[model samples]
Target: MNKVVCLAALAAALGLSACVSSSIPAPEVTMSKVTRGMSQNEVIARVGPPDRMRGQNGNECYQYALGKYGDVPFAVYFRRAAVVASERASCNLSITRATAGPGIVWQASDYAATRR
Candidate 1:
């Protein structure tokens, strides 16, 4: 009936308003709790789930939105299932390629065509 529909709509609006009123913790505060050498599980437990993930070969990078409104980029790198580095930047795995040299070499470009 019309009464039931109105009641349902009011309840839905109230629920949504409650969700919007809740506060989100600052990204820096959360990211600070994560540290290098931590396992993936530990990282998740400390900072909750990542917003996105990228990987190439055996390496993985978890990306999260930074800033007060979650508009900036942040990334945590993992190698061999362990945390290797954390940076206030985003990375696309395709930007890197395996070199036939001794150690890993990162190109000096922030944006580039993907390597095949």
Candidate 2:
């Protein structure tokens, strides 16, 4: 009886550990791939709708927020009818809102001129 109880306890411990490990979702931003001139529809299809949208200089900027993980804010810059640049600012949230600063900006030309 003691041996059976020990085996059951071991099984229970292993099961609990597995459940804990699997409960944390993988990071969401790793798969984000954006390019210039991709239409609003294309962006939606690839990354889903932005967490929020705002305007800048007559262009629309889509802000994709990564919740609470100190992940960066992905900003896609669109001008006229095409995407011009993409930027990501490493950010963290304080009590009520997110705080981010200037981040690396990747230009569309850089991505377009590359093959494969």
Candidate 3:
């Protein structure tokens, strides 16, 4: 019985660690593994799909807004199915694309959290 309880606790811990909450920095939320030449599907598999996808099928940018006080918005620009570039600033997130900014708009007061 004691062994069973310990195993269950371990499993619960492991499961919770996999979910990256909105409070966590975007880059820390599985973005470090993203690399050039990785297919869009791979990007999705690694970090989960972006909160917002813009542009068309081939040429697109996947944006994940940290929305926290000091987090720099992270975006992966994909061209022809692979990541081509990433921009540090100019981002937005929303319930729908209706109010989403076309690009990241980092304000002067916004600072990238250094440690994160």
Candidate 4:
């Protein structure tokens, strides 16, 4: 009887641990691993098309935004002809249309002069 109780307790603990260990997947954003001077097409290949795109100074710019419940918004900016300039935020939680708000705007020059 003692051995059976111990086994059952161990199984319950293991089950609880398994439940707690499963974590939500991270968000999918364009320009997650972008580099400088990467063409617009390359950025699309990695992160898919942006929610919206704009042109400035003859360069194309893309903006990717993700917002999740109980988490701050995530935004990534890509220059028209360059890789990601900088990540606006660090939130990695999954975002959805229902949770995501307005689109973010990225400027072309901001990424044009970036070294790396």
lDDT of each: 0.69, 0.53, 0.60, 0.48
**Can you give the lDDT of residue 67 in candidate 3?**
41
lDDT per residue as tens, model 1, 1-116? 99999999999999999999987887778778878889888988888798886654425678888766788788887776678778788855643222111244444643222334
Compared with the true structure, what per-residue lDDT tens digits does model 4 show for residues 1-116? 99999999999999999998986445533334566666667767876676644443324345555444414333443333554443555422222111122342332533222121
Q: Give per-residue CA lDDT, model 3, range 1-116, as digits (tens).
A: 99999999999988887664435544565557778888889988987768777654445567776545545567777656777666554443222122222443333332221111
Backbone atom clashes (below 3 Å) for every candidate: 0, 0, 5, 1
In candidate 2, what are the lDDT values of residues 4-105, reduced to their tens digit? Answer: 999999999999999887642233552346787777677778777877655423245666765446365676666543566666742111200111113323
Clashing residue pairs in candidate 1 (N, C-alpha, C atoms within 3 angstroms): none
Worst 10 residues of 3 by lDDT: 107-116
Q: State TM-scores per candidate.
A: 0.59, 0.46, 0.50, 0.38
TM-score of 4: 0.38
Please give the RMSD of candidate 1 to the true structure. 5.9
Best TM-score among the predictions, by candidate number: 1
Q: Indicate the TM-score of model 1.
A: 0.59
Model 4 clash pairs? 60-80
The parts of candidate 2 lying over 4 Å away from their true place are 1-32, 56-58, 67-70, 90-116
Q: Check candidate 2 and list the clashing pairs.
A: none
